[model samples]
Target: MKISRWLVAVIVLMSVSMTASAEYLETKVNFSERLSSSAETLVVLVPADTQELSLSGWSNETAAQINRAMQVREFTGAAKQQLEVIAPMGLSVDRLVLVGVGTPSDLTRIEAEEIGAALANHVNSTKAATVHVDTSLVSDVAENGRISASIAHGVDLRNYRFDRFKSEPEPRPSQSYEWLVVSNSAAEAYYADLQGLANGVFLARELVNLPGSTGYPAAFAEMARAALEPLGIEVTILGPEQVRELGMGSLYGVSQGSQHKAHLLVAHWKGSDDQPIALVGKGNTFDTGGYNLKTSSASILAMTTDKAGAAAVVGTVAALAAERAPINVVAVAPLSHNLISGEAQLPGDVVTAGDGSTIEVANTDAEGRLILADGIWYAREHFNPRVIADIATLTGAKVGALGTEYSAIFSEQEDIIRTLRTAGENTSELVWQLPLGPYRNVTSSRIADRRNTGSPGAQAGALFLQHFAGDTPWVHIDMAGNALIPSASGIHPEGATGYGVRLLTEWVKIYSAE
Candidate 1:
């Protein structure tokens, strides 16, 4: 389903307010200025207060000199015991919270997030309005910005509470965070990107967190179209008949089980006449596992999140448009619901796809790949894209292989793999490249066309989908590992993580130029 422009605006505003409310205080070791604007509260950072502690010289100090000094017994002793003595000076606030940054040379983005989260927790607990961070020690602009963004993203995502329907939301404690990057111009430049990324992340969270009844396939498509159309995105939605006319039998066959009609929605942003980068998503609005059926109540109930892949694509497009990224991108979503009914495609049934390739339906639970096959074929045939990437909760095998930390990427094109891997790493939505070659034991299928499932112990379903990609420079992301969160992480909340949106947007920005 599409998100409306009005709703997108509202969500963006709320996200900005929510993110701005968390106060983060950054400071140097030797700076002696006041830490808080108000006399009633102050949060401080000290070396001894945290788990690990160390120091590095900022600015004029050489890396070698800093490293050498860190090894000195006198310096080490001073650093280890520094915070304990400094804690009493800042008594203006109700509580003085101290966070330690270990060995400034080893300061990383993850460390910054840890510091930010600790500070946010303190402010949240105390109900402070503003946070004053002193960045007098940070010397690297890019590194500092990244660390700051990570901290803000983490705090914002964790603090997200979907209390829209509650009447008492106003009484809940909320804190606003502002970072004072004294000498970092790069941090200022990256602030806009951070804001946009936060907006996209929040959009994905809201979309996935909504109940299935309110977020049906048609409604999702409408919302997306409304959000993009005003920004000059060309939007089109093909109904079941239209899909049938285009011979999308695989997608059509899957939708037969559901009461909601299927939709193949496409949104295009042609910033230039360059070869488009195709983004496809498996938009299973809801899945009851069709004819095979789901035995576990948890699995069946969690089917509401099946459309997370589609939501990511929609969020990507919205963000690209919002940022005015100069790239040609086309997003295709094959939306449907898999339910049990007499009309549902049974096991062993073969359906021809848009490319006229027959797929043997081995298991209805593996239906995500079927619809995505249609989308990939459609994108290839219609747009002749230079690179094609399809995102989906295609398999639990991915989660088993990569766990919940990263998305599994399967691709035959090394360059596309490299591009995606770099983008994923930069955004912290990491992708671990999985083998896509035909393994002799799992490659042989006895039934029609190809088997969706490989051997019993086969752990690479993302690679399995590569068989249907034809000659396209395609990458399949098994978002099963990253799409929905049992809990919040980074900038994603308890629902949809919006795993691929930022990576895809960044990749496209680099792709179009090439």
Candidate 2:
């Protein structure tokens, strides 16, 4: 039955012809010094300190009416707060949207992005055909068009929708926008780089949202090639034979039961002559937890998201390459499936990694660390990177430790940890540092060099991966809690959050700058 299913999947994949590009709402944005009187919706930015709606951007009569309404509605222009008026008494536009900019301190790039996201959600909900944003009043606080570009970037992030597999996808309303900015602000130039980042995020979300039937290891490699190679990225796919030749027994053992062959996908971008940073991701295309098995329905359904870390690696590289960042980086993804089959690795099986480390499979369900062991080893051996950061949805203990608000980061290097935290804060992909060395005792093994499973899941997983890092400055990010969300909120719509793309992209940019 599984073989027939695999054949059907192959036929379906081969027959389904479509460009492998990421799907996102392409909101037409234009920057102008002149504000248009005719618009389906007029979005006005107001500062919290500016009481009575006192501003030179609008007519006195219009301002007076809005101020009266603000008093009646008690709209103080708080951050992420808005006041909407329909068919305003003096406005030419059909509707008026009063969005708050909070205080001077709140007028930042991040705040601008959030405001943009909030504005996009409102505009999308209203299905406005054309919208005009008046940003003249914000020039004092917003510098160099950063706020304007960030707002647009947030809109792009919030506007993402993955409906490719929908038999009859719901039609989305189309809208165009114009940003009325201060003269010579160069908002368009600033937005160009942000657009690239949005593309990368969309790609990651699309990969994660894809159903298991269509997103196996081989298919993922092909998709990565199709999406990245044209952008000047070098993509290499190591098949089962090549994987075994590299002695990636630990990575290979996890896929022994699957009909779809495993793959070690390598993506290299040589943007500079500096030593590259290595990013290793655990990619379990569809994990059934081998013989241990995920008994609950929710646990089984969530298995499709096990490959999210790999998706982020692909996304980050794509973002950096598209922006033409001046930094060299390499991505290593170990892709496989842990399914129950006669050939699947048993709980007691001992496997040898590419780096010649022996691991005892104390729990068959702990397969992410097993694959990551080889991936990290391969990256350090082949790429000779200055730093190695491995990301994975490795353990449920991470969710318990940090919940869904932050990913658990484990690293002995203070510089890497601090840099990652700053990047996370800047991008809103938050991370919290966890203990690394104290948990090494849990990985001790009686029969092998180490054991895959131990007490305190998150730390054990991190410690297990640290052994393979081999003196390289490494940070292990267990993003099991934040990779996928239950519903749409903030900048994300729903399903896959694409948690690490923006965070990692920012990290690369910061690292490159240093």
Candidate 3:
């Protein structure tokens, strides 16, 4: 997951060459050019003036192609009112695409991107060997470069297919894109950072899409160790005995039901000797809702994705290492599977945590916070990190509050909250801060030191986990909503979303800059 700076540099270099080689064609009003004039598929930049059907130049093409291009124009034109339209002139290609670039001076990076993405989608469907996106109307070099990068990012991420287990796999198709940017120099300089971001996103998707059976605790740890250790990252995996030695009774209690032993994995990337930024993840490899159990088949079917938070942490740390960002980062992943068995910890049982705090188990289904508690305690007590953030599919209440669109964040630190919110905005993986204080009342128990669940209708379960984080300036991310996708969007497919990786990476990037 962590990328070395060296790898990032290499990827950037390749991107620059690729973008430069992709030619950009310019067309004036009333000009008709053959789509297959060049080896690459043509990209027509449609200005907003041409969005409406005028029939200035037309005829002899299938109505379906014209309609599809019109749909693209309508969709892109509404968003960017000044966009220009592009289409193939002759029958050399299967289809022609209309890319809309709004007004020249008023054009934004996002608008330019809409054109590029539209072009990519057009080429992908046509099975074209190459795509030529014309960007002659735009004058700003920086904006052009950003648009190219965004287009590439969208196309690459959206095209991802998880066909690993498919018996009848489709043959790999050969296709390439040629981006015609106004300024070649600007594109070259901006390509590296853009590619690094794309790489990070791709890595996150891969980690999240892996099946739970193949992504077990030990297997996950091994994957981390193999990918990171060679890149100067220090990797450590603590077995059951080691976890018990540290008094992680809450974590052990959850693992008692499953055959697979628990594992606490630590991956450290010391880009600086300064105080480390700590990230803890709850790794419930498979959650059958413990003794409470899941009622519906859907709930049980998707329980394997409970480890999504841990997967995000692993992927983020790997990207950081791979990018070689100059900041000290450490991740703690507490892995376990919640199943039913004679040895499983029963409800109402009180268990001691790593910090000697006892928790009353009101619901075995609330196991995420238990393991996360130990992980947070371990991070603080052992690493003494400057700031700690723990992510987990901690509560269904979070999903009830935010739906599947955003994550719910609970933190005592206002500055951290602000920074995280900004990062979320940039990445589109938004986080809405919720009240953890209200949940504290429910977590306070009479018999044990604390209870996982508070009052009967406790609304914010993310805050309940904050109680065990101590004074580590911790933030709890309830990823119950953001971990997977029920539908596809932008650059993400339906399945594991890998939501937090980009947000966390952006946050770390800002911290390193500071």
RMSD to true structure for each model, in Å? 6.8, 3.5, 7.4
Q: Tell me how far the alpha carbon of residue 159 in candidate 2 is from the true structure, in angstroms, after superposition.
A: 1.1
In the range 91-128, model 2's lDDT, one tens digit per residue, is: 66788999887764557667878888889889988867
User: In model 2, what are the clashing residue pairs, if there are any?
Assistant: none
After superposition, the stretches of candidate 3 with alpha carbons farther than 4 Å from their true spots are 1-37, 44-87, 90-94, 101-120, 171-174, 182-185, 456-460, 511-514
- Candidate 3 residue-pair clash tally: 27
Residue range with the least summed lDDT across 10 consecutive positions in model 2: 13-22
lDDT of 2 at 93: 78
lDDT of 1 at 257: 75
Ranking of all predicted structures according to lDDT, beginning with the best and ending with the worst:
2, 3, 1
Alpha carbon deviation, residue 266, candidate 3 (Å):
1.7
Top candidate, metric TM-score? 2
Of 1 and 2, the candidate ahead on TM-score is: 2
The order of the candidates by TM-score, greatest first, is 2, 3, 1
lDDT of 3 at 506: 80
lDDT of each: 0.65, 0.83, 0.67
lDDT of 3 by residue, 1-514 (tens): 2444543443343233222211111111111122224534555454555433322245545444554557664544333333222345543444445555555546554444444445444555565675565555444666666655565555655555555556996643346556667666666455555444544455455545656665666666665565556557798999888899889998989988777768899988898888999989888888887898888998878876788788778767766776677889998999887888998888899999998989999889888888888888889988999889988877777777788778888788887898888888777778898776544466777889888885432243555666666777888887886776777565665677776777888887775565
- On TM-score, the stronger of 1 and 3 is 3
